[model samples]
Target: MNLGRYIRRTAAHQPDAEAVVCGPVRLTYAELDDLSNRLATALRGLGLIRGDRVATLAANRAELVVTEVALYKAGLARAPINARLGATEVAHMLRESDARVLLTDAAHLETARVAAPGTAVKTVLGYDGPSELGPGYAETLDGTAAEPVEVDCAPDDAAVLHFTSGSTGKLKAAVQTYGNRLALLRKSVMSADTRIGPGCRQILAGPVTHASGMPLMGIFFAGGCAIVLPRWDAEEFLATVERERATHAFVVPTMVNTVLALPSARDHDLSSLRQLVYGAAPMSPQRIREAWELFGPVLSQGYGCGETTSGVLFLSTEDHRRAIEGEDEELLLSCGRPLAEAEVRIVDDAGAPVADGEIGEIVVRGPDVVPGYHNEPDLTAETFRDGWFHTGDLARRRSDGYVFIVDRKKDMIISGGFNIYAVEVESVLHQHPDVFEAAVVGVPDERWGEAVKAVVVPRDGAALDEAGLIEFCAERLARMKKPRSVDLVTALPHNPNGKIDRRAIRERYWAGAERRVH
Candidate 1:
């Protein structure tokens, strides 16, 4: 039931194949396997046993990927820390996960050292340079042999602790068992949108710690090259795609928007791209169309979260082509059908199935689903019940089995007894000629209980007024569904994972108000 054995097998078969690339650093399959083996041996020598936690706080780099594979080989659970977390939050996660050692890089070494003292973190190892906390990364790996360590692990043993992005509330770790990870690998290899083999290369533009990292194993298992960019810049990404002849990439909607807005976005020779997979947030239909226009029909959409290990449903490249060709106009807004061996249902408050085209909470049952949240029994029991994990997203299932996400259950705004979905309004807002991006939230209102407000960022050098924007929505939607007020801003705030921060937007308008909607 070991997942590490798969990589070792691939390394044996194709030792000279390119495995990972970042900047000037490139590693063959043999080199990557040996480095991970040495690191695993070093961790074993440090008294780390099966089931012990090892945390990593580094950006997208070769070492981050190496440490994750090494942890799997050592039969240790990996607790990947978000590189953007504050010192206090870092300490909280270390204590909560009870990590034995913290593996960090030069960028985050000082913060890791500051957070290690008051937590269960006993040692700190940096990827480069001297560390005040313990030893350098190279120093720790010097004495270990470049051979695989055969550690035994059961299918149900914990393999990875995936921390939720916390866009809604406090962060929690989803305990992805070894079986769950195996299921992820199986699903990914079978997906039409993510499958890759030798001579294929994929560009990773987002932080690999979260959604962007989901397909790493599938690529490795297929003997494809993973080109890692240290940071994300629209121009740099396009240049890389042209230079490396990248065949695939995974990105969020926000990154797509940034690239589309670039003046030279269409000038690059992106003919080699076969698939552009997008997720982590709902993209407006207008933006998706723009992306399809700019990138041809190479766009696909994947829908999942940290709890599902990887995408449970994928909108294939063919699906995108169908929508673009106007065969199924409504399919443009769908997140596509559930993948193989997975069951998806839409249920109401009492767990009853809703009629087609009606909204409800999405519940999923599959081998890739996590068993529960780590160390939180009550919360786990509430979420995982009746053999299904209840996703907090609200969606509607169409007659053809396509699912359309409406909004987060908690983010829905009720104004004057009518429910308003933020995504629905934002989608319409994006269609305006002068509008670049928009976010909708519920603002406090004494008369209506809550008012729908829009924070808009207009296109550069475009003249737009609130009256005109409101009129556009009013003509397209019912009067009640239109935003009551609009606040034009230069840019919307984004969380660390690159999703729009709606909670921060709500705080600006709901301060000191005690209004609650039941």
Candidate 2:
């Protein structure tokens, strides 16, 4: 089934149900569908044809959702540009994707115009506000028909060309198919009986352009209400949760850490949040325990990459219970088991399966896995060897079958002929009572090829010196695993998706290096 079909089905079955709530604006399923139909008609009038690409450069608003639905309904693929990207990066993506039209608001109009100067973008639609482009956004369907255009879309048709964060290097577009998206939604619905129902509120706080936004479609598929936040704020997130009575919400580890640090967290009434899913980065066991204490046992974890439609593995509620009860320390470090219709395995460098309790590259295969990258054939072939997508993550599988991620292939540090996983060091550092967040990276060393460095953010008003932190890590970890230097900061840099920007941190140390990986 097509991704656009979700919107149509929900609109038809629950026409009056609240589909989206952004700030003061709220749209019913019927309204959302009709508005998308109008946008589709407008796009067609601008000479957009089947298979043409349309790009959106907006925040998490109703317009962004409408643009995606309209483009899909008209048999056009939609590319949602990350609002945090620079002009040159945005332009490169537009040119690479061959976007035929751009839908942007006043906030990003100049950036969009500068990016695609003379590309295939023939028409640009602005949001409803004053801008240099003229008065405001215009409706192309004043009295036009609201019926959806009948365009043929197969499961193999490219539905989305989403760009990755480019942490390794230049951003690459991941081609998503109708089948992949359908598989994700189907899995989400059947995973748990706590399905989103009519008027069930969902909070959208993460970047809508990222994979985190994919699950929001599942809420739409289940005829639920989505509360969109333009950006995430600690207090605002809590307020929205309380005011909207949101049932489901997704946030990265950084966001959760920020919310927990808020002084008002204890004062806010957040009883409405039922399922709080956290991923996109590793969550410290200490932080998880504190969150469980505050938010109860409703927190869950999802693990996946952009290459996968969204989530391939789910750390279920029962797993959280096991962790809370101190059943196993390894379970807390795991990203949990694979979801239904997914297969996960750890393989060695030669693609041979590794034995349990051994570390190797994590490979996944499933219906939600994308066929390949958009245009990088060589990269696609290299990544999809032997019918499994190599995740570039080092992981070890316990005898119990739960996978524990060691570190990224590039993030591993070798010092004095000893291998060190940054995650292992960071996990130990976070166990300290004074440390709020920590990131471990390798830096140049004279005696050793590399030395482990810990960048930490201390708990508010808590005093943590470098010597004390080193001593704390040394108490629990081996001498070689201890950090050589500790850098304390108020907050760690984060990417648009809210994950710690390890690339940025590495670049500071390896500015002139030829290779990023040590």
Candidate 3:
């Protein structure tokens, strides 16, 4: 099977249609088909064969999307690095993935140039123009013919080296096979709530190298427009939707929080939005309600990670309405049920299915699930076993199949012999009108072994104190689950993917301690 053929098919049907748009750059399907074809041919000309890895390190740009399609056409695996990653991590991933080619932009040129020397990277193509690294991206593709090159790949052929640092700050790649990626495309367009068709436009608001880029293939397969943002700005995102008449958008919770904080959010002409999907992190039920009010009844929550390729569970726009406007209020806390082609089960420690409403680790077995992490056999065996990938997210499966994420397995706080989930407490803290952001972490304690501590960022101009916040949580949460102490901060730390960094908050209180846990 080959994915590139779909691009050619779409181009044949609507060659003059806009395929991608970023700032002043717009590419018609004809241009997209030609560029990807030329680039794929050029890569083959570079002596790279099937399964060879190509890495990309750049900010959000149209070229990144082209590179992904080109990699697919050539039967090559892609390893995309987030631009925010430091040089050390960049070098580590380059070596880990054994990437043969590095395509980068001027902002990250120095890092790639410096890091590629000792690794398997043979060439570095700059996005802006030629540098000492190699020729410009356009120059490389220009040297090749635009004739189509579709490499036949097996279902198990390596397609993507999906890398993530996660909470531990260690980068690892999930070996996503061709079949897994094809499953992603199938599921993306199968659901009416998320399907992108002709005359539809999607704004990729985050870094296209990761979560935001997941929809590109589905959009292309259905002949839709992908409007990529050159950079992320909350107001610009809203304005682009108004200007481009974008029908769909995918953003993380941090971006949503920023957009909701804008005083002029209501001033923008945001009526054209049909589906505003948010994932990669959780947004509290309160924020979900606020978003529904502001963005209308078009909010979807996706739950999955790199190992799962993309979202396996999606809380559709209708699910949001059922929770907010209808009687199923508890559904607001759920991440929703499994989508097509994915089998999701909440299992106990022994790898057996847990009873309904009992918390367990989520295990998924499906075409979209990556086989295992690259070069980490031990970890691979630990996470992917008995044909199911064990997601370390602790969640409870409702009888209706909705999954409620309680906490990351490692983030659960055992204080005074009672297990307290940080997310449960954070969910309560989010209910307070004055709280803008909150992170719950287990801190060292003399008697309780671990005490629940909360770090909060209050709303602008809203008066709040540690005592008041603690009292608020105590009113809603059980006494043992409520925060024993609170620290008021202007902002909570965030990892690269824009989720609140709970690990960083716990580090401050655990410094110089004998063990991480009390």
Candidate 4:
């Protein structure tokens, strides 16, 4: 069934229930549904056909959410572009996706116009400004009739195309189906009644273009209230949580680190926060511990990629408690077991399962896993072999059934014939009292073929020299696993999704290389 049906159902069931909030502005389920239908009608008036691609370049806002639901209702594929992406990257995605209509707010009108010059986008609709299409672009559709349009979309038909970091190379759009999204919501509900709590308000700070924000659909599916933060600010986030009585929220590692570093962190009455989900990158155990101490056991972690539409492995509240009680460090480091319907395995080079504790390429098979990429048959063949999605991640399954991700299969550093996972070294560095965040990469070495380098961001008011940090790592890790060099920085660069920009880090060091070989 089409996802737009859910919006209609929710509106009928709870017409007056709070649906979405952007700062002070709010909309009920009935209002949101009607607005989306009117927007769909507007797109239809613009001569948009079924399966046409409509792209939105905006942050987390009520208007953006309205546009997405409208696209789905109008039978157009929704492609939400990352606003943090560079002009060249945005141009490439617009050209590659062959978007038929482009939508933007005042902030991104110039960028959107430049990115898709001479493209099939017949008109540009800007929110809340005088556009070429005139001033009616941002009107509320409250009184408009909700006329549902029928389109031929199977369960497996592509509903959204989410772009990956492209840190290894060019960005790849991971195709997500309606079936996959529904499966994710189903599994998430089974894992825990994520909707329970007084004042069930949720804050979304991550970019809506990513799967991190896509889970908000589940909140909507359950008829819960969502508060959207256009961009992340430590003070603003804390204030919103307290003022709105937000019970749930999720942010990436960097945002978590920033929030913890805020001087007034302890002063905020964040008691309303019941569940704090964090992922998209490996967070330091020390950082996690600090977060637990500050926020209580409400903090949890989820592990997945755009291919899975957000989370396949979820570290629940019980797991968080176990980790705090010192049950097992290995379990704490793991991304947790697969969801009920998801199957995860570690496989060898010959497509055979490896023994427990043996590292191999991680593979996952489930209804939630995407079947293939958009149009790249060769890459799809390489990624989805034998009906399983090869995650390109190296991991080992523990005796307790949890899986610990080592590193990207292509990111494993072989120095002096020793296999070194960058995460292991970075985790060790994170244990240092002065270190706030860390990323480790492999650089070319004449003697070892590849040498390990650690780039670190120190915590506020903490001083960490290279020697002290190296000594700290050497204490916990073996000589070969320790970083050969430690470079201290105020902060590491991050991609739009908030993961460390390792490619940007390596480019400076590997400029003359023919190719970047891990």
Error of 1 at 83 (Å): 0.6
Compute the lDDT of residue 510 as modeled in candidate 4: 88
Between 2 and 3, whose lDDT is larger? Answer: 3
The TM-score of candidate 1 is 0.98
> Model 1 off-target regions past 4 Å?
none
Question: lDDT of candidate 3?
Answer: 0.91
- Segments of candidate 2 deviating more than 4 angstroms: 129-138, 141-144, 512-517
Question: Candidate 2 at 187: error in angstroms?
Answer: 1.4
Candidate 2 residue pairs that clash = none
Model 1, range 336-390, lDDT digits (tens) per residue? Answer: 9998667899999888889999999999999999999999999999999898999
Candidate 3 local lDDT, 1-518, one digit each (tens):
99888999999999999999999999999999999999999889899999999999999888998999999999999999989998888999999999999999999988886788789999888899999889899888888899898999999999989888567757889998999999999999899977999889999988888888899999999999999999989999999999999999999988988899999999999899999999998789999999999999889989888899899999988888988977799999998999888999999999999999999999999999999999999999999989999999999998878999999998999999999999999999999988889999999998999999999998898899989888998999888899999999999998887888888889899998887762
Clashing pairs in 1: none
Clashes of each: 0, 0, 0, 0
- By TM-score, the candidates rank as 3, 1, 2, 4
Candidate 3 error regions (>4 Å): none
The digit string of per-residue lDDT tens for model 2 on 327-368 reads: 775578889878878899999999999999899999988888
User: Model 4, stretches more than 4 Å misplaced?
Assistant: 133-136, 139-145, 149-152, 193-199, 513-516
Compare the candidates by TM-score and give the number of the best one: 3
Residue pairs in clash, model 4: none
